[model samples]
Target: MPRFAANLSMLYTELDFLDRFAAAARDGFQAVEFLFPYAFAPEELAARLHENQLQQVLFNAPPGDWDAGERGLACLPGREVEFRAGIHQALAFAQALTCSRIHVMAGVVPSNQRPEDCHSTYLENLRYAAAAAAWQGVQIMIEPINERDMPGYFLNRQAQAHALLDEIGSPHVMVQMDLYHLQVSEGDLASKIRRYLAGGRIGHIQVAGVPERHEPDVGELNYRYLFQLLDQLGYPAWIGCEYRPARGQRPHATSEGLGWLQAWL
Candidate 1:
């Protein structure tokens, strides 16, 4: 069976961020993930996870200046220093939380910059991050977000992410495959999963409803079948529930919308 992790960043929006951990555990989720942990102290986040007996499966390295429309710094030419600093900070949190994976977002490509330059910078930065994380026994994850959702995002396809991993040539670095992005950008998801998962480069997996980004069962992709496929392929990793509740942010909306997960469980 595929282990599922609640993405606290998206789910449980009605509760405080710290309170979401207990809510997830109460809902029977054994693990959790989120976008960024930089807003809170590592000790505080760690305490919640310990209290809930929840494993912190994944989280992102800081995306530079989120308020200024900056999504990530990995692919930006002049932000290598900031990107590396963010990696160090992420690893520190990973250690405190006993988390083993960190997602590094490839920022939006600047209109004035060359794609080739961005590609080179992305490779260099990932290699550096992988090296830094390896010492901490943590792996660095690179996700290919869809351009529709994040226009001009540097990475946008599974093959593209795997090829970059090839160039980076570090076992500590791998792709963070999100099915929602895969369905939007490229629809041959089963083939992509088999191809990449078989190749041993997919470090983590995430799921959300297609088109609307709601609970997985609300999507057209048929996650029940995909969940079975994952088991058939022996994918032994956590699948992060990275989606919003279709129930909106009303009280208990996240829990009420967990029929999909409960059915599988």
Candidate 2:
């Protein structure tokens, strides 16, 4: 059976950073993931995880300014120093929590910046980050955010993500196949999964309903069928629930959308 992990970042905004682990546990989630964990102390976060007996599947290296629209800049020139610092901060937390995967955010490119230039920088940064993560048995995943949500973000498609990963040429570096973003940027979610699964290029998976970007059933994507396809492929990782609820209600609201998942498990 595939283990399901809740992304506390989007699910339960009502809870504090440390409380998310316990909330997920109480909600019947065996594992959890988040976008960033820089504000919390590593030792403190580790204690919470230990007390709850939850596994930390994924977390992101901090992007420069999430609120200011900086998003991420892993491929931007002259930002390598800042990028390495973010990696170190995440590594500290990962070591304490025994996490095995970290998502590297690819920031948006300026209107004038050339794709070739950004692509080159991305490959270089990924190579460096991958080597650092390899020492701790951690895999670094690069996600392609959809253009609708992120106006000028680089890497908005699976094919582009795969190509970047191939150029990086490191087993430690792989693509984060986010279905929601893929649905917006490119359709045929199941076919894309098949392609990446066949090539062994996918490192992590995240899902949300398309159009509304809410819980699975509230939107266009057929998550029940998607989960079935994942099962057919024999995927053994967590399917991260990375979506916002229709309102500020409890994370359980989204859990209801997952009722079909129980059938497969």
Candidate 3:
């Protein structure tokens, strides 16, 4: 069975941030992940994870000023100090929660800065993050968000993500394959997964419907088959459910819409 992890940031809108852990457990999710868990103290989050008997699968290393529209800081030039500091903080939380992976979001490339310049900065930061995380037995992940969803975001394609991971050349560093973004940026979903898996760089995976970004059952992608493929491929990691739980369908609706999850598990 595919190990499904509820994305608390996208789902579970009924309660406060801290309360989502219990909600996920009640809904029968084995694990949970979120955009950023840096808001609460690491100790508090750990307590909730333990109390709910839920595993903390994944979370992004602080995306700089999310409300300010900053997606991530790893690629932004002159932010090396801050990026390194964020990695340290993320690692601390991962250790506290006994989580194994943390995503390093690559922020946008400014108009004045060349893409090459920004790319170099990104690789530099990842090199540092990979070294730091390897020490703690925590893996570092880079996700390729779709251009439509996050315009000018430093990383936007699976191939690009794979190239960067290859350059980093660390077993602890891998790509976060989000199928929703993959459909938007590059098609050939199954082949891409197989290719990345062949390279042994797929650290994590996520799924949602292609255009609408809803529950996997409603979208163009055949998540049922994909889930089975992961199982067949011996993918032994959490597949994050990183989709919006349908607008206006808050609180209990989140659990109501978990039929797909129920079927997959």
Candidate 4:
């Protein structure tokens, strides 16, 4: 069976952030993931995880100034200091939460900078992050977001990410393959899974309804087939449920939309 982790950032929005731990656990989730953990102290977050018996499988390194429209720092030139600092901060949280993987967002390319420049910066920063994370037995992940959702984002294709991974060449670094974005950008889902998952470079997997970003069952993509494929491939990592509850603002919205997950369970 495929292991699923409730994404606290998107799921269980009806409750407080800390309280979502219990909610996920009650829903039969054995693990949890989120976008960032900088807002809360590590000790408090760890307490919730311990109480809920949920393992923290993944989270992102800080994306620069989220409210100001910055998506990430890794690919932005002259921001190397800030990007490196964010990696360390993420590692600290990972150690506290006992999380093994951290997603490092590649920022948008400014009009003034060349894409090649940004790409160089991204590769350099990831090399630094990989070295830092490897010492702690943590894996660093890079994800490709869809251009429609995030225009000007430096990374937007699986091939681009894999090519960069080849250059970086660190076992401590891997790709965070979010199927929602993959389906949106590149539609050959099953083929891509067989191609990438077999390479052992996919450190984590994520899912949401394509085009809508809702529950897996609500999407155009057939998650049942995809889940079965993951099982057949023996994907050992947790698949992060990174989608908004389809119920939309109703209490227990996440739980209500979990009928899709129950079948897999």
Candidate 5:
């Protein structure tokens, strides 16, 4: 069976960020992921994971100033210095937590910038990140968020993600494929998995129900079949459960609402 990791950032909204670790474990999740971990001390977060026996499967590098609307700094033209610093900070946390993957978000393209210009900068920054991460034995992941959820985001399609990977030519850089985004932007999930996973391009995977982005069981896609497909292809990475609990099912009712994962387990 494919292993599943709870996305604490999106899943356990009812609890505080630090408390989500234990909540995930109590819900029968063995591993977990999140958007960012910079606010807390790496050692403190490590202690939580050790105490709960949970693995930190993945987390994103610090996206530049989220409230100011900076989704990521990697694609921004003049933030190369800030971007590199963020990578080091992420590595420090990953090392303390024993996490092996970090997804580097591509920032939204500014209205004044040309797509080609931004993409060129993105390639260079990813090249730097890949080399730095490879030295520390951590893989760099690039996720393509759908335009609907993150309009103007530089990376938004699987084909574009793979093509960029080919150009980067870094063995350590891989695709952080989010199924929800793929379904939104490009609907042929089965065909995409067959081509990408079979070829070993996918480094990590995240899933949620379509339209509502809730529990996978209620989604338009047959996630149960996809889970089987992961095993058939011998894809061994963790499948991050990056979704919200269905309405009225978060916080106090989390564990009971985990029926979908219970079925898989």
Candidate 6:
């Protein structure tokens, strides 16, 4: 059976950030991932994970000024120092929580920056971050945001993301294939997943309903078939539920959206 992980970022809006662990555990999630958990101290977050017996599948390095549309800056020039600092901070949390994967958000490109320059900078920064992560037995995954959702973000296509991973040529650096973005940017989601899987390039996965970005059943993607395909492919990693609730209710009601998944599994 495919392992399902709840994205705490999208699942538990009713609880404060610190309380999400208990909420996810009570709701029967065996594993969880969060976009950013740096707001809390590493020791405190570690304690919560132990208390709840939750497995941390993934989390991200802090992106600068998340509110200002600066999702991340790991690739921006003149920001290497800040990027390295962010990696160290993330490592602290990963170590405490026994996290195996960290998604490195490639920041938006500066208006005047050349594409070639930004790409080169991004490669260098990712190489350094990957090396650092390898020391701690963790892999850093790069996520490609869809252009429609993130207008000017760097790394917006799966092909581009794959190219970056190819250039880096580090086992520690791979791609976090979010099916929602792939569906928008590139159709034929299964083929793309197969290609990445064949090349051993995919490091993690996240998914949501297609058009609505809500629970799986609210949109057009056939997750029952998708999960079956993944099972056939022998995908042992956790597939995260990174979607919003359709009725604006708590994610515990996600069972409604995942009804098909329950039966499929």
**What digit string (tens of lDDT, one per residue) describes model 6 on residues 1-265?**
8887889888766567778788778766788898998777878978888899989999999898899878897879888899899999998889999999999999989998998888889999899999999999999999989888988889888899888888997899988999999998888989987888888778788989998898877678988788888889988788988998775665455444556456644
Model 5, runs deviating above 4 Å: 248-250
Which model, 1 or 3, shows the larger TM-score?
1
Superposing every Cα of model 5 onto the true structure, what RMSD results?
A: 1.1
lDDT against true structure, model 3: 0.88
As a TM-score, model 6 comes out at 0.95
Q: Kindly give the number of clashing pairs for every candidate.
A: 0, 1, 0, 0, 0, 1
Q: Write the per-residue lDDT of candidate 2 for residues 100-142, one digit (tens) a residue.
A: 9999888989677787888888888889899999999999989
Query: What Cα-based lDDT does every candidate model obtain?
Result: 0.94, 0.83, 0.88, 0.94, 0.90, 0.85
Spell out the clash pairs found in candidate 1: none
Write down the lDDT that model 1 would get. Answer: 0.94
Worst 10-residue lDDT window, candidate 1: 256-265
Q: Which scores better on TM-score, 5 or 6?
A: 5
Evaluate candidate 2 by giving its C-alpha RMSD to the native, one decimal: 1.8
TM-score of each: 0.99, 0.94, 0.97, 0.99, 0.97, 0.95
What are the runs in model 6 whose C-alpha is more than 4 Å off? 250-258
**Model 6 residue 136 lDDT score:** 97
Q: What tens digits encode model 3's per-residue C-alpha lDDT throughout 17-46?
A: 888899999989879999887778999999
RMSDs, each prediction? 0.7, 1.8, 1.2, 0.7, 1.1, 1.6
Worst 10 residues of 5 by lDDT: 248-257
Q: Pairing residues by index, what is the TM-score of model 5?
A: 0.97
What local lDDT score does residue 201 receive in model 1, on the 0 to 100 scale?
85
